[model samples]
Target: MEIKVIAFDADDTLWVNEPYFQNTEKKFCSLLEEFLPQHALSRELLKIEIENLPLYGYGIKGYILSMIEAALKVTDNNLTNEAIEKIIGYGKELLNEPIELLDNVEEVLQALQGPYRIVVATKGDLLDQERKLKKSGLSRYFHHIEIMSEKGEDDYLKLIKHLDILPNEFMMIGNSLKSDVIPVLNIGGHAIHVPYHTTWAHEQVEAKLDHENFRHVEHLKEVLGLMPV
Candidate 1:
């Protein structure tokens, strides 16, 4: 395998992300508990968030709006302005959360830096993703940073073209099988799945993949061993 470029997913792959979003979700549920049970509110919020994805894309800003919409829906459009403000505040706090690098992230990047063209290929709001990358302190190790709105097969194909590499010459590493692994494999590229303790429900896939271009590792450091020597 002649892998020239190695792209890493940002959220939950390079750093702590989903848990912080989950924490904010709990807070959101509590704020609207009077209108519905915690479980009900969580379901409503997830429904609204999924619906809003096309319009708002992925990020805390979209999440804030979705939470407000959920609160309004659950409250029969009788929620107060104060409740809306609190939801916005929750999102702001989430956006301000510190970047916590995942285990062995830096060590692995340092090991592969000179040998491969390392880059970040992630999906999220452009500003938010850029800010997180700047805060991560791992940006210097990346040769390029592509903040995508989606990670579909076509999107990755474009990225591969822009990187001046064929699909077979590219490799993607991330936690999401839906976004990171399947699409890359479908495009005839290599993918490595480094499972995180928590993953967003939308990114979850139940299928067991068996592909020559795919590798699932329990830890990020194991990627070093998979590289062609």
Candidate 2:
């Protein structure tokens, strides 16, 4: 079947998203360790964050504040109104910073735009994804930009239905084995997996492929070469 819609995952697939989060996390973890070693603050905060996923979703802004709150609770650290305000200010600054895109990502997308109906199917904090998409200036390349809270077989099914495209005619391209590749394959869509050198722990999964429509590659740019467009 001739492919009609080509959907790409936004985070690690198109650019350097996980690294920014990792850097922020390391800084926050260090701060917690230095100030509140007695309570094992970082671990506790991570647990809280995980428990709050349904409530807060994913994003650096929420994460920063959550860390701060957890630190205050565990260490008996009386964060004054001024200190808390300052931390919020820092989080805002972090949000303003430009997300670094991977090399040739925009170029490759531009190259592929002429022939395929390009769409960005990313799962994350909606606000953060919006911020990153706008900042990257590549939003125009996509026919539709979907910011999903989660990715699974059902998500893929719903997306295909909404787009009015058959599973055999859609291709999902992404970096993670779990979110990007397996689920799409299970739903009978073609999946092109371009492995990133570094993957977030949560996004990583076993490199297992049992679907006939699945394809794996080493680089992002090579995807354009494989498809008709």
Candidate 3:
């Protein structure tokens, strides 16, 4: 009840993200379906993504690289120049996507803004996250923005230090349990999981949680009732 900072994860939490990526994945699978079945290519792309996470980090650029790599594998290095161009086009489309804020995002932020030192603590390419935040028009609500390379306990600890808030005095709201909830909970911060309709395979986690500081909400609107007005 004494939380001083409320940090939100940017991607799916604030705006539509995974669904766009899912659609792009479908386009990708279709593009290479002749080289391999849709299901197989999808799995292969995920495998490459997870494998490439360290080198490329996270975001559209990494996803594009994985797609190109998968295409090469599926077609045995015989992928057409046109196909490569199309894949690059997919990445460009994702990068140029309009920010569509999730339901109640601005409303809830408006409600909580005065009471909380709101911030964005999200993981992605800095340029891309900054671009999305700029497009969302919600940047003014946040006191600070932390675009992380990764979200782990240490990262949250560093953020708490930067913000000069105790772990117990910080709360994180996000769509990914793996990236958002677990790390905050592990660091003794509060977290609420606001599940999105679609999730990337990399962000999925099993639901057997045992942390007292963690809560799950059916929607962003429900989060309003958890604190004072």
Top candidate when judged by TM-score against the true structure:
1
Q: Is candidate 1 or candidate 3 better by lDDT?
A: 1
TM-scores of all candidate predictions against the true structure: 0.98, 0.87, 0.98
* Candidates sorted on TM-score, descending: 1, 3, 2
By lDDT, the candidates rank as: 1, 3, 2
Residue 80 of model 1 has an lDDT of 93
Candidate 2 C-alpha lDDT tens digits along 1-229? 4688999999788878766665665655555565666336546777777776787776776676686777677658876666566556556766777778887898789888999889999887788888889888998999988888788899888888889989988999999888888888888889999887787666767776766788888888888778866
Decoy 3 TM-score against native: 0.98
lDDT of 2: 0.79
The predicted structure with the larger TM-score, 1 or 3, is 1
lDDT of 1 by residue, 1-229 (tens): 9999999999999999999999999999888888899998888888888999999999999999999888888999999989988999999999999999999999999998888999999999999999999898998999999999899999999999999999999999999999999999999999999999999888989989989999999999999999953
* Predictions in order: lDDT: 0.93, 0.79, 0.93
**lDDT at 122, model 2:** 89
lDDT tens digits by residue: candidate 3, 1-229:
7899999998889999988898999999988887788899999999999999999999999999999999998899999999999999999999998999999999999999998899999988989999999989999999999999899999999999999989999999999999999989998999999999889988888878878899899899899999776
Q: How far does residue 89 in candidate 2 sit from its true spot (Å)? A: 4.1
Name model 2 segments beyond 4 Å from true. 35-42, 76-90
- Which of candidates 1 and 2 reaches a greater lDDT? 1
Worst 10 residues of 1 by lDDT: 220-229
